[model samples]
Target: MEIPQIPINEKERLEALQRLEILDTPAEKAYDDITLIAAEISKMPIVLINLIDKNRQWAKAAFGINFCESDRKHSICAHVINNPNEITEYKNITEVKEFDKNPLLEKLNPKINYYCGIPIVNKENLALGTLCVIDHKPNQLSDAQKTSLQALAQQVMLLFELRKKNSSLTKAKEELHKQNELLKNFAGTVSHDMKMPLSNMILTIDLLKAQYDKQLDFQGKKHLDYIKQASFTLSDYISSILTHYETDKIADKNNVEEIDVNHLLEEVIDLFHIQEECEINFIEENPVIKVNKIALEQIFINLIGNSLKYNDKNKIIISLNFSKDQHYYYFSVTDNGVGIPEDKKDSIFDLFSIATSVDRNGRKGNGIGLSTVKKLVEGLGGKITVESREGQETSFKFSIQKYSQKKTA
Candidate 1:
């Protein structure tokens, strides 16, 4: 028997087949179902969804057959792949000199006599395999049977393409996860190493100011103060980097618990040492909801701190309100602080984005707090937004999932 000639694009064809990663895989119902239908439509007792490997034709799905594979030289599907544009049909193998003495035909239980194969060609025109049917007696397929078999071959190619796409996506996601983990570890190490030197520098500046209180000129003291402030800002920036990287880990480790809104707000306010002159009011009763305590605390601390830092009014007015629906709890923090400009509002939540260089108190901030708050809010499956009129008032609104027993589990 004559061996099939390889296609001109044999190298690329083999590469595409290997990339699919489908050879020798367990039989799937999706593929098996196609083979069953193909057999039924063609009135053939045997059908196969074959993948032409480098040296063998492997059956991905077979109907009315037990053999899993056969040599490429004896596989009709292998020959069909070379002329992918047309189906290969043999009314009777015995009349074909090249295939009459084929070992597969000689060994068939019912003495194989008829064959038809439709090449499984991908989008790039690379023939990977075939959807083939065989009969025990000499026969020719009707025009409709040929069309149906070709259509089924296209379906087989689509399944292969889809599986490859899904595999690629899964690999990409895993790589991204690995890269994020590395970044977090790097940020933590760098932040920890930096804190000591910054603290030492601040302490040294304090000592200089105290020891030479009268001897130092006004400009010298002012420069030293600036150095202290800049150093502190740098320290805060490093801390923010650590927080941004570690927030996901913290969320994973913590347990969700029912939290009293009033008590939580009180604790957050106390942590910020809210100025006594500032008028802080909860407009309505805070509802108890299940949430990650640490994430909630971090969100409020940043929002409230921003409100207090950016307010120009003699008596800053801050209001907290809450509402809820079946799916989520919505909260708002309103303040008479310097509002964000229309242009700046879009990117205000981005990392290191500062809408204004100087806050109301004339202190420069590192512009990491709002970004951190946004990350924390999103991690808890929530969204945050802002409404503001420039130089008037700013209100921050956010939503978080309402607690459910299934969610905790």
Candidate 2:
């Protein structure tokens, strides 16, 4: 028998086939189901979802077949893929002189005489293989049956496309995971290596100003202050980065405990050391919660800290309230501070996105705290949103799901 001639774009066709990564895979139920349906609809005894490889016709799914594969030289599928867009049918293979000498003829138990192969073409217009029907008797498929067969072939190609896409998505996930790991490492390195030096620089600037206050001119003092501010900004930036990176590790059972909200609020209030006429209130009847206390503390700290820092008012009034439903505990932190602008509200929780507002000390924000708070809130299986009236007040409302509890006896 004459060997099937390769297409002019044989290299491209083979590359496309290999890209599918379906060659020699074990039979899948999805493909087998199609073959079975094709067999039933077309009244063919055997149906195959064949994939044409460089050296073989691999049957990924077969309805009535025992053999797994056959040599490419013996594949009628090779002939169907040659035209790429048309279905090839032989009413009687023995009557067709073209396939009379093929080696597959002698290997068939029932002496197969009829064949129809539909090209399984992909989006790239390359025919990877065929969905073929085989019979020993001289037979012909009706027009509707022929259409169904072709549609089934398309389904086969769709399955191939899906497999390729899922593989791509899996690879992307792995790559993303690797990137996150690297970023975590980089953040850690910056935190450890740069924090101390920045602190030292700020301290040196302070000492220089204090010791040489009389001798230093206006420009000299300004330069020292600039250095100190720069150091503080960089140090804050590094700290934010570290906190953001560490957020993923904080949402777990390790920190979950029975926490008293009153005590927690007291600690959070003390953190800011406001020596001004400021009021921070958290009044909850059921003050205790079984949850990730540390994560909750971080969320509260960031919000309250923002309330204190961004305020232009003489009296910073911060109110905190908590309520619980069956599934979640909701909290609201409202502050009479310099509220977020309407235009900037949408992106306030995005990393490195700033509203360009200076704090009470005239220090521009590092724009990391809100994003970290959002992460922490969502990590606890809840959502957070902000509502603000630019000059009047800003409120952060967030929910965290209740922790799973074992049923007590």
Candidate 3:
């Protein structure tokens, strides 16, 4: 039989194999046991768990085999990895071109006359390795044996998938750690750079007030007041930035607690000094949820503050409602505000994305508020959605998972 040379997706295939992390390790009894069972079931003396590496074939489990590995130049298993969809059978290897010059046939054990190998693949459709049974005699495996071997090959594929998933999760965790570190560093740098200039400006303003107050006319006092207002606005902007940074930091920590959502909303409303202006209504029978309290508070604060700031009417109507799906609890903050445009609604949650407005009032939005809410909801494996028009009603609907009740004494 002629051995066909196939072009593999080498980069993806190698990455898939490495992601399994099963190469060059101590023997696993689970896999070894499978091979042992295959040997018994197939009536073959030699059964091996073989991985196709860059230039070598490595064994994770082997039965009735003295050698742990051999060169991929002459490996039947290497060919099997490339053709994962089907099992490869060889009555003899001497006819195959890839194996004709190999030391395994001449200098090494020439006893291996028959081969049956099955490919092990990951969920990504990348073939990683193979499981095979070999015999000294030619054409040893029966149809039943081939069926059992194929079944066992599926088990091996499952093991590879489990390993690959674990590897991916580990990589993701490491990336998150690195990103959090960068955020912390950025926060430190921004705090120093921004605060110093603001401090200097404040000091200069005080000096100007003392030096020019007595000599100045009413116009000068108005100019001084304008400078003071600008300074205060800058200070508020800085505070907003700091608030954004803290929101991210809190979300990263994910400190969840049992919070009274009603009380929390009330607190935010009171803090806004709009406890009277805004008609705040909530379903108060059991408005409790397990959430990162600070994040939840921030969500309410942002939603309500936006309503109060943007609404043209003297009295703003804000309502908090809750519902439950099979997997999560949904919270909706509905309001009558200067609603967002339909075209720009999709980008509302993007960082530094401001609402398109003809008049951006003294509200001084940092634009990170909605983004923070988005991240927090996603981090908690939840979702957020918005519905709004340009000048009508606006509603923010978000969901969070229902926490399992822990048994307490």
TM-score, one value per model:
0.89, 0.89, 0.66
- RMSD for each of the candidates: 2.8, 2.9, 6.5
> What C-alpha lDDT, on a 0 to 100 scale, does residue 161 get in candidate 3?
69
lDDT string, candidate 2, 1-409, tens digits: 6678888888899999998888878778999999999999989999988888889888889888786889999888887889988889999888887687788888789788899999999888888889999998999989999998888899899899898899999999999999989988988996989988988889888899999999999999999988888988898789888888889888664468998987888888888788879887777575688889889988998999888888889998999999999999999999998889999999999998887568888888888999999999989999999999998999999999898867898
lDDT of candidate 1 at residue 230, scale 0 to 100: 90
TM-score of 3: 0.66
- TM-score ranking, best first: 2, 1, 3
> Residue 239: error of model 2 in Å?
1.8
Clashes of each: 0, 0, 0
**Poorest 10 consecutive residues by lDDT, candidate 2:** 279-288
lDDT at residue 216 of model 3 (Cα atoms): 85
Residue 401 accuracy (lDDT) in model 2: 87
Report the Cα lDDT for candidate 3.
Answer: 0.76
Off by over 4 Å in 1: 24-29, 252-254, 275-277, 312-315, 406-409
Model 1 residue 260 distance off true place after TM-score fit, in angstroms: 2.3
TM-score for candidate 1, residues paired by index:
0.89
